[model samples]
Target: SQQGEEDPQALSIQEGENATMNCSYKTSINNLQWYRQNSGRGLVHLILIRSNEREKHSGRLRVTLDTSKKSSSLLITASRAADTASYFCAVLYMEYGNKLVFGAGTILRVKS
Candidate 1:
């Protein structure tokens, strides 16, 4: 079974607003990473937060990890219409493979 599960299966927001998504996992992970995928396009890696790290940020994106709760969150600041995409949270297990195990993902639609 997949280790990570994302919440708020779908979301809709206006441009300039912030979009937040959460992920919960069942086991201890080496790291948690977030990715974004535009409709019909490939997935783009966003930010990654290690189990030892509490938070991380890249550009307009922020990621937080709470190992105690086995959860993580992604925040997109000042979202734009172009931000409309699907976001996924992946769990990395060293004992497994180097590839990431992703969740079902959340669909976000940003309106202008």
Candidate 2:
């Protein structure tokens, strides 16, 4: 079974705005990671927050995790046309070793 599922299947926003995406999981996790993928390309690692960490930030990206609720959110600040991509949340199941289960992802379009 898929451990994580992202909300807002699709989103459209203008440049310079902020885009927020959410994910919910079905099981306990050791850690959760966010990834970004451009059109027709492989995914790039964005950020990872441990089950014990409430939040983390990298560059223009911010991620928050709530293990108690089995949920997480990703925020992209100052959105740009190049930021248009699909965002995914992957969960590292606590009982599944190092395997990461990925969500369906949220397609974000940033119009300039």
The lDDT of each candidate is 0.92, 0.94
Off by over 4 Å in 2: none
Q: How does residue 22 of candidate 2 score in lDDT?
A: 100
**lDDT score at residue 71, model 1, on the 0-100 scale:** 96
- 51 Cα displacement, candidate 1 (Å): 0.8
Task: Give TM per candidate.
Answer: 0.94, 0.96
TM-score of model 2 vs. true structure:
0.96
**Cα lDDT tens digits for candidate 2, 1-112:** 7658899999999999999999999888889999999999999999999999999999999999988889999999999999999999999998888899999999999999
* Per-prediction tally of clashes: 0, 0
Clashing pairs in 2: none
In model 1, the clashing pairs are none
Write down the RMSD of candidate 2 (Cα, Å): 0.8
| Candidate 1 global TM-score | 0.94
lDDT of 1 by residue, 5-26 (tens): 8999999999999999999987
